[model samples]
Each structure stands twice: as C-alpha cells, then as structure tokens.
Target: MEKHGAETYGELNADVYDEWHDIDPTDAVAFLAQLVEEGPAGPVLELAVGTGRVTIPLAAEGIDLRGVDASEAMVARMRAKPGGDRIPVTIGDMADVDPGTDDRFAMVFVVFSTFFFLMTQEEQVRCFANAARRLLPGGRFVLECPTPDVARYDREQRVEAHQVGVDHVRLTTVRHDPVGQRFLGQHVLITNNGIRLAPAFMRYAWPSELDLMARLAGLESVGRWGGWRGEPFTGEGNYVTVYEKPATPAS
Candidate 1:
C-alpha cells in the first residue's frame, strides 16, 4: 500500500460506502434534529459529510444543514442522491472546515468515527478549534465516536471475517501502532466478480483526550451518552458526546 492522504479513503470507497456500511440513519437523524430544535437559530454544519448520509435527510425536513468534505468523489456521489445537491457543501478538509459563509452554525458535528481520519493529534486538535471557530457562541459541537478497543488485536495485528455471504465473503485485516494510536486497515472483498481491497487509516483518541482537545478550542463538555438514544456512558462501547461553546468567553 502507498501513503494515504486525507482524501484517500473516501476517494477509494465512495462507490460502495453507503452499501458496504449499510447503517440506518434514523436514530442519528432524530437525535440531531432534536438538538437543532433546542439550539440557537442558524444553519447546521457537518464535517467529513461523505455522501450526505445524514445531511440530506436533515435538509429534506427543512433544516438548514450544510457540509464540508475532502473528497470530491464522495461529494459528487452525494450530489447524485435525491435532495443531496440542494444542501450547500464546501470541498475542504474537516480540519479546516469552511462553508464559504460568514454565518456561524448553530451546531457542528462529525459522525461515525470520521474524526479519526485526521490521522494525528495535532490535526484532530486543529479540527476541534476549527469547529469552534465556525460555531455561534453557545452553539454545540457533537461527535459520534466509538471507543477504540485495541484489546481485540494481538501483537499489533489482527484479521477477522467482516461479511460472509453465499456468493461473497469479506475479511478485514488490521495493523495497529500503539505508540501513535493509529490503525491501518484493509478490507478484502471476494466475489465471483473477483476481489477488491479497501484500505483506511485512522488515529483514535480516548474521550478524556477529546475533552482536552475541546478545552483547547474553548469548548466544554455538556453531555456524553452510550448511544444516540441517551443511554448512560458506562466506560465501554460507542458514545455520542456534546460540547458547547460558552456564551461568554472566559476571562
């Protein structure tokens, strides 16, 4: 494999992203819509908004949702979806989210562990700061991230079955760099049509580390949950966390 850039994952996976991931956005969309209802009046922004999975539905329901993504291919796929082209999108890195508007967002969010794609603590911190800069004072920043479970791997490497179908099978290989908190993954899909390899790189951070990042961006944590349905976080599994920019900056 060659060195992967910020846009590499989306560029490679755009065509099969939605199908392969096959996640239901119902709960997530509802959770976000509720936030918008309680939030201040302003457009909402999504970072790493590949294929408008959550953005299109929010816009269809009359929410002023916009997006920023690094991969033109992913954005193009989104534009091809129903109501996808209507939402404004800026082609840019999530670390430097810019929608080309002076208006601040009521909320800014990145879902599905996409924030890990920043690949470094420095980039992730920059992303938090950028999200802060784009929000209205007192507005919210939300992140839907899974707890990184490194114990699943053995000696920094692991392989497992991802999907098993009558005519197709998929296996995933993972290599971990514990020192850097980075993971390199490759998905092997085998079918009568031959085999395909989908690769991705991510740098995972713990919730405590993320809280510090938010603080550096001048935001504070207001909520954390085990899921979007508001379950309590019990030190395991996926979590949805909300941070707010203070209405008044600290002296």
Candidate 2:
C-alpha cells in the first residue's frame, strides 16, 4: 500500500464521511457552543474540518466558526452544503494550524480524533505549538481523542466489520505499530457492483503524551473528560481535553 499524505483521507472519504461515520454531533456541538458562549469573544477555529459535519451546524447557530483542511475535495464537500460557504476555510495541513487570517481565535479545536492525523510526535507537538500561536491569550484548545487500545490487535493486526448490508459489506483491516503508536488501515467496501478501499493512517498518542506536547507549547491542561459532556476520565475510552494559553505571555 502507498503511504498516505495529509490530504489522502479527506480526499478519499469526504463523500461518504457523514454516512459512514454516523457520529452524533449533539453533545460535541453543545459542548463547544457553550464554550463559545462563556469564553472570550472571538472567532472559533476547527482543524481538519472535513465536510463541515460539526462546522455547518455551529455556523448555522451563528457561531463565528472558521476551518482548516488539507484536502480540496473535503473542503468542496463542505462548501456544497447549506451554510458551508459562509464559513471561511483555509485549505492546508491541520498541523500547520494556519487559517490564513489575521484574526486570532478565542477557541481552537480538533475534534473526532483528527489530531492523530499528524503522523508523528514532532508533528503533533508542532500542531500544538501552532494552534497555541493562533489562539488568544487565555483562549482554549480542545481535542477529542480515543484512548489507545492495544488489546484490539492480535499480533499487530486486527480486522473488524463496520457495516453489513444486503447489497454491501464494509470492513476494516488495520496494522498496528506499538513502537510508533501508529495504525495503518484500509476500509474495504464490497458491494455487488464492485469493491472499494480507503486507506487511513494515524499516529495516536496517549493523553499523557499529549499533555507533554501541550506543555512544550506553553499551554496547560485545564480540564479533561471522558466524553464531550464533562464525564470523568476513568483512564479508558475517549477523552475530550481542554488546554488553555496563559492570560499572560510566558517569560
């Protein structure tokens, strides 16, 4: 399999992103929307904002939300949606954290495990530093990421079924690299008509490692939750972490 670049996932999955993922944005939207209401006044930025899944609804509710994406194809899907065109999106690497605007944001976020797409610890740290640079002092940076599950793989590989239908079946085969905390996967869709495959690659870091990245960026962890609704993090499952830039610049 060819190595996937930053834009590969969005290019391949943009069309089916909403349908295949089927994530309920209710909790996520409510959580971020509340932050927008309570936090300092400025526009919000979302990294890897593919297809406007959460961006569209928040924009519809009148949040001054902007976006950055690596893929033109994914951004196009977002632009085609209602209200999507109104949300300014910069087509670029999320790790770059450059939305190509003069405005610093009150909040910067990368949800739905998108941060893992950075593919390296150095890149992830760079993303944190860049995101912090894009934020207002005292502003928040939020991330939604799942805990690493080593048990899922047997001998460094795992296969699972995602969907089963009369006309089609969807499955994923993943190769894990424990040393690198990486996963290379292929989503295989088999239909009566034909077969399609979407390649995905991620370098996942534990929340503790992410905390180090934040600290290196001069940000501090203010909150950690197991879910979007402020549930306690019991050291398992997903975590929604909030890091804050200090109100004053670091000496």
State the lDDT of candidate 2 residue by residue for 167-219, as single tens digits: 99999999999999899898999999999988888999988899999999999
Least accurate stretch of 10 residues (summed lDDT) in model 1? 1-10
Candidate 1 RMSD to the real structure: 1.2
Assess candidate 1 and give its lDDT.
Answer: 0.92
Backbone clash pairs for candidate 1 read: none
What residue runs in model 1 are displaced by over 4 Å at the alpha carbon?
none
Give one digit per residue, the lDDT tens place, for model 1 in 18-137: 988888888889999999898889999999999999899888778998899999999999999999989888988899878878889999999998999989999999999999998998
User: What shift in Å separates residue 126 of candidate 2 from its native position after superposition?
Assistant: 0.4
lDDT of 2: 0.91
